[model samples]
Target: MSRSPKINTVNEAATKYQAAPNEEYQLVEQAHRGVPAGAFFDILGFSGLTKEELSGLLDVSFKTIQRYQNDGKKLNALNSEQLLKMITLYQKAEDVFGDLVSFNRWLRKPAIGLGNQHPLKYMQTPGGIDLIMDELRRIEFGALA
Candidate 1:
């Protein structure tokens, strides 16, 4: 693995928010009234996570998610935070893998470093996001086994 300062910089920026678990949510609340729901659609397509899985991650019913999509409504703070996390992770994955196809493939594949869980399976929680991000950091620094 070849490290890039840019990736490390992004990794550090992402890690800084780990302490304030609600910082992302708060930022959403403070920065914008809400995030456009279509952004969710875009991220879902990018992340390769199922709609149900993403709804679960946002703690929203699938039907509500559909409503947001159909109505073009803005997502609540919680959902915005969740979506932001997904987007950030997706961007980092793209940076690491050099393309969406490769990143999506890696996301679906089991990894020894992640205790045999596919990275996509870990997107439901903040800690799980951290695990994936940390794994990315390791790979970035050539620290992987």
Candidate 2:
């Protein structure tokens, strides 16, 4: 009489019970902890705004905008109104651009680099930074005026 093949139930159970841990899971989790500029660009692109157009709308220097994109500056400094406006503008841009990959690439590379002088550099203004801070607070708290 031929004997049936021996089944190693314990070995099978041990193999089944072993949990495969993903080493990169923690790194991926940490990477998403904060909003990076790439995410902002993605949002903006998805909404549909060109880098130049956005820079103009924000009243910030193009170089400054580039810095924000390259450095991953936090959006916490923007007011809710500004954020809303940005959202709207980005949506509009999306309608016009239609391709997110191209839009992101363009955002990373402005028409001009950081050497260009901004129009606002010559303006003598007081409390501008303070106003910006206030607006940022409003944006963060969802209290735009």
Candidate 3:
């Protein structure tokens, strides 16, 4: 018996989250426990979103993010939940598109399914993240819409 290598995600914890994504209970629990501030920074870099954009999505100011980083604190529940979802979203996107470059390109381009809006424009809220996930699923299933 041979074991295949695990597909590494951008964030290790987010990979775990993605591994059992169907379990909403697990996701809620992780959200309640909060995520490390560094996780946000890591995802920010990997996500190709500017700090200002990411901060807007996470509902925090740039200074707040810097303060969290300086203090080495965990994010609050709301921010944590959104961050986890965003990380997981990026991981799935990279998987669907085959690479960070491709995914980033898709993110910036307007999609017909999303009313000809850039995906990045919809990443500011949790509901928007869910919408993007649906879009990714559509792409994965050869149902580009």
lDDT tens readout by residue for model 3, 1-145: 2222343456564664442445667766887887767666667656777788888878798898877767777788878778777877877887888877788888889998898999887887767878898999999999966
For model 2, the superposed segments whose C-alpha errors exceed 4 Å read 1-40, 79-81, 88-145
Clashes of each: 0, 9, 0
- Residue-wise C-alpha lDDT for candidate 2, range 8-104, written one tens digit per residue: 3222211222211222343224323432333334334343445565555556666765576576563333322243333333333333445444434
Scored by lDDT, the top model is 3
Candidate 1, residue 10: the lDDT equals 28
lDDT of 1 by residue, 25-144 (tens): 664553256666655555554465677877887778889877776777778765666666666676667677777677778878897789988987787775687688778777767786
Best by TM-score: 3
Q: What is the lDDT of residue 131 in candidate 2?
A: 37
* TM-score of each prediction: 0.67, 0.29, 0.82
Candidate 3: Cα lDDT at 78:
79
- lDDT agreement with native, every candidate: 0.64, 0.36, 0.75
